[model samples]
Target chain A: MRRLYTILSAGAVLGLAGPAVAQNPGDTPAPAAQADPATGSSNRARSSQSPAGGLAAVSGEDAAAAPARADGGTIPPAELKSACERALRDDAEWREALGRQLTGALLASLDQRVDDAEPDQPAKKRKLEPWVEQLSTEIERKIHQRENRAIQRNNNHVIMAYAALWALVLGFVVFMWNRQRALKAEIAQLQLEVEEAAADDE
Target chain B: MKQAMYFVFAGISVLLFFYTIDLIFYGTPLDAGLYFNQKIFYYHVPQAFVLFLAVIVAGVASLLYIKRRDGRYDDVAEAAGEVAVLFGAMMLVSGSIWGKAAWGVWWQWDARLTTSLLLWMLMVGYMLVRKYGGPSADRLAAGLAIFGAVNIPLVYFSVKIWRTLHPEASVVPGLQGSMRTTFWLSVLLFQIVFVLLLIARVGQSRIQRQVREVRERALDAGLLD
Candidate 1:
């Protein structure tokens, strides 16, 4: 009974302990504190590559002129690096920036490709226009799907972590429960013996 | 007197069971603003509460047997433990099926799921301890039941403290009134069923004990010889 109790207690402790270890504070880095340098650099690079980059060279260009455009603003390298570091650590912000950069890049590339592949003549151009439109739509859809997949993967990782934690807790509870049951049984047996002894004496 | 009480409990359970079915078929499917998987809630949550209540009954009966050494109390504990195990098992199966329908997965390691599983295992352990732990099994079974009962709260609170997948309890202060009424009704109906089952099982156990006692007395008197 003692041995069973020990085993059950250990199992319960381990079960409860396992999840705490798995959910270590170190495992889930504070999202806002750690920015992804890659996303920051990518956004910076894309901004530089946009028509907004041209406006940066124009003095009269209002900072808000390309609110809807992909112009590289005068974000200081030091500030950008800090923001990137912060974003990398912070999943929400990193994802938002990554999504914006990816969408902008995709649209810009599509525009450039269409310009380069101009169709010739009225009848043939009309016939090809629908095909071009369909291809462009397909590309955009694929990009969205890729973004969604990344988000899903991240969510799945969190879920897996939670599952492990729960399993540990369940194991611990079962262990403790078994131990308690065994002890109770032992006590009951001892009590019965005592009762019988008293009755025999009488 | 006991028989009359049993009849009352049985009648109430029968009435509520029909009422639950009527609510499911006729009542507006649980509103979205109220709670997700509303239809499953009526049955699943009540069954879970019933399972808990059954275990508590077992624990109480076991304690009484230990203190008084009344063979009758042991009978009650054993009966309650058996019924608790049955209801706990049903809760697990039904909860899993509901989870599959609502969450798109058959099971998730949510706090509620983990705790319920632990409770079920404890219930099984209680039965096993009674069966094999010797003639003085009542004390042991009671101890096990008490220990298992203590863990129920820990299991519940663990999810709240940790980042668990299980949703927070829906019947909170901010919850709408309609959902609360439905939830309370389910709890009441299930509690009635649990009581009825316990009484029926206890009666059967008492009958069995009486039969065993009569046979032992006859053998001692050499009536068979």
Candidate 2:
């Protein structure tokens, strides 16, 4: 039951904090520890007590980005850029941590199974590394698919925006041009009428 | 000479448009969270600036028309009001697209967006009154223009006054590096475009007024039935 709870907790952590952790390469080791529920509380305390340098990386970036976020809520562009770069670079680190935590739970379950197995049953070789590796690969693939979908959505939004802007501007210009043409024709027609009226008066 | 000057100005505006487009796409760095989507800011914010400028111009000209009772002032007011409607529509449309990209929602009834929508609607009302309000159309639109001009400050300060999805005015002042340069260049470009459009629209308005006067005289003289 404890193992089941641990696996579920790890999944919850990964789902919530995975991308955040991947983007903070300079973060102290507190995150890796926090990723595991067993040591989360104690590790958080240790990190809080650690010297300022341990948190300097994140703090320094935040300081640089402070002006852009003075309004308090919006993420600044520079910080976002740096975060994206770090996420791209340290993506493997996050996947490794996730794999370790997930497989850690699986291994614990396997250990219980071994303990309950008869002494002779344990003599049969059980290689679990390949299965663990395959599971990790599947998770990574799913994450990549989700990221791609998000990126595609962003691209679509941007293209539609630019298209809408240009289309509207062009439409307005055409409207003005057509109005000018119609007015010019009316003016020409009015001038002819005035000329004919003057001839009739003479 | 005036026609030559207008052509020169148009040429320069075209050149600036190309130059700024290159700078926006290539010279400026990608912003963090929105990535390529943030590029919309280069166009969106500048159009907003032009929108405000047009509305203000319309209000001031309308005030002059009311005080002086001059048809030229009315012409200027009408031209500026038309430009305001054009740019206001652009601002709202682009802004909605940006909201969709950044906030995952196309429209939010937040303070800034709501106020901007109101301002745009007022400008549309100005145009509609001008088209169908008979001889008093100019006066009615001028009134709407003054009201819209008053609304400008509300839209400009909406983010500060209330919690909103739109960025604060400080965001422009806070920009740094290439982002700052690109942003100002975009503002300049949009302003030039606004001036050109205003001049063209004003010229058209003047001609329309002349045509009306000429037609009225001919009718008084029994030139046509």
Candidate 3:
């Protein structure tokens, strides 16, 4: 009984420890430099205002700059490069934030998309609708992945519980089987002594 | 003294049965809904308590049997084992039913449920070994009973040691006073039922032994001739 109590207490302590070990690896908080505040607000406004035209302008600039950077020659002046870098960084931040806002807007637009692919007032609506759809899909995929991980953790817990139960039961059965055999042998020996005493009396 | 104890047990069981009914009807219902599985709690938890009490009683009786070699002590141990098996079986069945209702499945390999099922199997196995294995079976059965009884605590603690969805110990460090009062009252009532069942079963065993002795004597005297 004391042995049982010890094993049970040990098992409970382990169970309590498991969740602490398995919790999403502490999330790391995303680098502070990459999380600019102005980018978030601009992204929201751009996605609500001119989405497609904004994406097209950014993509065009990116395409033109890619070849210039690839040719790594004398390059632009330090002042010009720094100014361009700042502008591009700010633009990229805004685009990223806009992508997040569009992701939410796209989910709301899904029923509208199904009802009519072309809007009556097309100029008034956000033009980069496809980019919004793409962003939303990515976010949904990430959410699904997170849910799957939670489910897997739940399953692992169940499997561990069953494995422990079976181990305990099997261990118990083996112990009892051996004990029963030993007791039978002792009982037989005692019976033999009783028979010998009876014979001596005779 | 025995008669007085019997009356006490009878009174407690009656009181508990009514109290359980009152709770079912008037208590703050759990958000889980009022299903047949919920109703089973009145009987299933009581049965589980009885099973635990029976195992403890058997352990104590076995200790007495070992010291005294008195047939009466063996009788008590055997009776307790039988009663434990009966209540354990009920607990297993009702628990499975409750699992089906709560989990949308007939059975789960959860720690608490599996440990309980294993205990039931052990108790049933103990009784079978005693009944079919002849005169020396008592000694073998007694050893198995002690071992199985001892494993109860281990089975209970398995959930705590392993990560399991089965809820943690309800009687842990921080419980509200009202919850504790209800829990203790339930335990007390169940303990009374355990004593009542133990006495009834042991009395039956004693009567059966006397009848067997009478039959043996008649056979020796050639009463049929």
Error of 2 at B27 (Å): 2.2
Best by lDDT: 2
* lDDT for each candidate structure: 0.63, 0.76, 0.61
Off by over 4 Å in 3: A1-202, B1-5, B32-43, B154-163, B171-181, B214-225
lDDT of 1 by residue, A80-109 (tens): 668766776677766766556554554455
Which docking class does model 2 fall in?
acceptable
Candidates, ranked, lDDT: 2, 1, 3
> 1 or 3, which is superior by TM-score?
1
lDDT of 3 by residue, B136-214 (tens): 8877778878888788888868754665655446322443454334445565665675666667667656655555555
A101-139 per-residue lDDT for model 3 (tens digits) = 554555445435544775554543445444444455557
TM-score of 2: 0.65
Estimated TM-score for each candidate: 0.49, 0.65, 0.47
Error of 2 at B14 (Å): 2.1
State which candidate has the highest DockQ.
Answer: 2
Alpha carbon lDDT at A11, candidate 1: 100
- Note the B-chain TM-score for every model: 0.83, 0.93, 0.79
In model 1, the runs with Cα more than 4 Å from the true position are: A1-202, B1-5, B33-37, B155-163, B172-178
User: Candidate 2 residues B151-177, lDDT tens each?
Assistant: 777675764466655665547888999
Evaluate model 3: give its lDDT: 0.61
Clashing pairs in 3: A11-B160, A11-B161, A12-B160, A12-B161, A43-A98, A52-A128
